[model samples]
Target chain A: MSKSLSYSSITKKIVLSLAGLFLISFLVVHLLINMLILFDDNRELFNAAAHFMATNPLIQVFQYVLFFGFILHIVLGLIIQIQNWLARPVRYNRKGYSELSYFSKFMIHTGAIIFIFLIIHFANFFVIAKFGHIDPITYDSGNTYEDLGLLIIKLFEDGIYVIFYVISILLLGFHLDHGFQSAFQSLGINHSRYTPFIKTFGTLFSAVITLGFISIPLVIYFF
Target chain B: MDLTLKIWRQPSTDEKGKFVDYQVQDISADASFLEMLDVLNEQLVVNDEDPVAFDHDCREGICGACSLYINGRPHGPDKGITTCQMHMRRFKDGETIVIEPWRAKPFPVIKDLMVDRTAFDEIIRAGGYISVGTGGMPDANAIPIPKRDADIAMDAASCIGCGACVAACKNASAMLFVAAKVSQFAMLPQGKVEARERVQNMVSKMDELGFGNCSNTYACEAECPKEISVSHIARMNREFFSSKLISEKEK
Candidate 1:
């Protein structure tokens, strides 16, 4: 059967790459804002950054795009994976792991776990900031903002929640390690000169992003 | 040296298959892997049992007919060579080797180890040719093609229609094989006219044949007897994308 013009394998690959990279960029912005916690002793700086992200009109518009990007990336990823699974109906009895990396083979596993974590993340923070009631914190400088930072700190105080957050961050890192370079390859962006660099950058980006996110729950829990 | 083989055997295509253990003794290590199989088949004939069935033509490794998944790798545990080119010396004395046919929905086994690879022919038929008038061969220098393009075209032309790329792939994708054909024609002047339709039709046929998507594992290159580059896959993707866009605008 002829595939639809818009959702062919090539088109799906291109969409996956572009949306994946957009989500990666969002990670950078998110990590930057999140890093404010490490800078100041109190929640004022972090709250100010969070408040800016929550209230800014431009970021708000982009936030919808970011959500759409995530859903698109995820749905396309599942479609490709399902078709891949059906392409080989029979299972290999003595399957070898010689040609594929762990991240490449285990993408679905990591992605599913990450999806659950994302729902929890949005529920705990995003939903509450937008809809649910949150107490206001008054600063000594006569400034008042939502006490979202204190809520985050309290949520991290639970060892289980902190552990869950750290584990999920690590899984996200594993997904990104293969994802960054694979996106470029799927988009037909490849060269002997730059591919190695992209692979290296992928690994480095995964580590930095995971470490940055993990530091938050660890710090808020123990310190 | 004596060797033990755990080879997959199925009575027919519809029935389930299982691994059958057989012993072959005093075979020369210098003999090719297929030659050793020939010895075993001879023994089976003497015992009044049906001999093992596998595919082969031009055992020197050029025809790309011999395909076997030996020890969990396509074309045996060697690099850049077909199963017919693999030597028995790669296996140690008394080693137990596992052999199976290509594992993919598109490649169904015809017998013990021979699979129906007509799906590949269908993909090629979809667009692997340049139409020309029925006349005398064109003059050699009439087209005046660049040397670099010809060389790369020749490189892409190295794919032997062997399904190792599909066998080696975790997803059983034929992207590398399809890509090689697409790139071979896309780089040539004679092929430029049908390049767009060639890639599109071939890709659609490949998809319709139930082949998987490329996940960039590079397994196809590693297992291919021709060592076809994965870059061809990327090039084909670029071609397919541009062709789709152009076709859409034309529509």
Candidate 2:
């Protein structure tokens, strides 16, 4: 009963994991930029960072790369998900299926919500700030479009958008809480002694990402 | 001691199953878990009531026929033991035990706590073998397998093809079981000739049988009676990928 190869299942997992890691790196950079809003009161430095990101030649190139990376990540994630769904077409009807961690079972739901959030996030911040007309603010170097503060304030002022943002951030936390260490394990990094530490690190990273993003709306609404 | 049991009962594979409660009294704490079931069955037979159906063969824990998802954990609360090997002492005097068949879609229940685990057999039939023909026994020392490889093969061979790995997995994945089978054969000299084909065929059969993909949660390893390492899954991935590469090169 010698079997033949269908496809490389691991390749799909590896692709999804690498893409997730890339997105994590993007999160770190994005967080660094957002944290600057806390520092410069006048919004000049924020605008400068925005301008550099939008207009600088190297960053412009990187932006295209990031876009491609995001697309690849989403496509690979969906492919893996579809394959998984096809593999087990039937749903378990029994209760207490959540004996395993609730977060692990709800990954698909969390992932879908995060996907929707990413779309809204890109439309609101990236598209409006990049291509759409926003209020212009004059800086020492030059003039850069700068309505992000106003946009943030307006979005948060609407309680619905605020709620959606909060919920999405929470779901993102849930996704990362599992995804972080899972990606490591998928790449064969599971030493029993190190796995606990890695899981803790993963939890910390999820908390940071969730709290960091949630703070932006809080800062806008409160301050 | 009186024990309350909520056992899942289904007439056939087509009909939906539901939990039915039964009570048994004065059961000894030291009885093996299957013996407790036997006591219940004896009561049923005497009373002329239909006895609860469950799967068990050796009762010594070697045959792997005893499969029960008891109280949210596979094979009761104890680790490193099958359901048949579990003792009644694990439960309190008046405690209630919830028993159900393995809940994977591939392992459909034919009766109370008895599931059709033939999907596993089908997957094994798909590729779990070496094509070498049986002949007279060769020289004892000839074609020696390295100590490490032999040890690993033994570890992999420890799997009993029980559906516990699938039952224990959050995704109901058969990866650990399939990996164990593939690795057991792949480690031996006779199996080397068909290693690539074996992995590929077994994986295809696994997929065709509607077992979910492994999500690397390690739940399979956690609930496995044999404590099969997740590393075997990694090996399966490596073997499958390399086989694909080699096959592509041939093309």
Please estimate how well model 2 matches the true structure, expressed as its whole-model Cα lDDT.
Answer: 0.80
List model 2 lDDT by residue over A1-223, tens digit each.
2222233456666667788888888888888787766566667766667767887898888888888877877776666566666544434434434233447666778888888999999898988987888787776667655746556667887878988999999998988888888777666566658878988999999999889988977887777
Q: Native-contact fraction for each model?
A: 0.62, 0.18
Q: lDDT of model 1 at residue B199?
A: 92
Off by over 4 Å in 2: A1-12, A56-102, A141-150, A153-163, A192-197, A219-223, B133-149, B186-192, B246-248
Kindly give the stretch of ten consecutive residues in candidate 2 chain B with the minimal lDDT sum: B242-251
On TM-score, the candidate that comes out on top is: 1
Each model's DockQ score? 0.69, 0.31
Among all windows of 10 consecutive residues in model 1 chain A, the one with the lowest summed lDDT is A1-10
Number of backbone-clashing residue pairs for each candidate, in the order shown:
0, 3
Best by lDDT: 1
How high is the TM-score of chain B in model 1?
Answer: 0.98
Error of 1 at A113 (Å): 0.8
Fnat computed for model 2:
0.18
- Candidate 2 per-residue lDDT over residues B1-251, each given as its tens digit: 78999888888888877888999999998898889999999999999988989999998878989998888777877888899989998999989988878887788788878989999999889999777558998788899899999998999999988778888777677989999998898888988898888888888888777777677777787788888877788778778767866674553
**Candidate with best DockQ:** 1
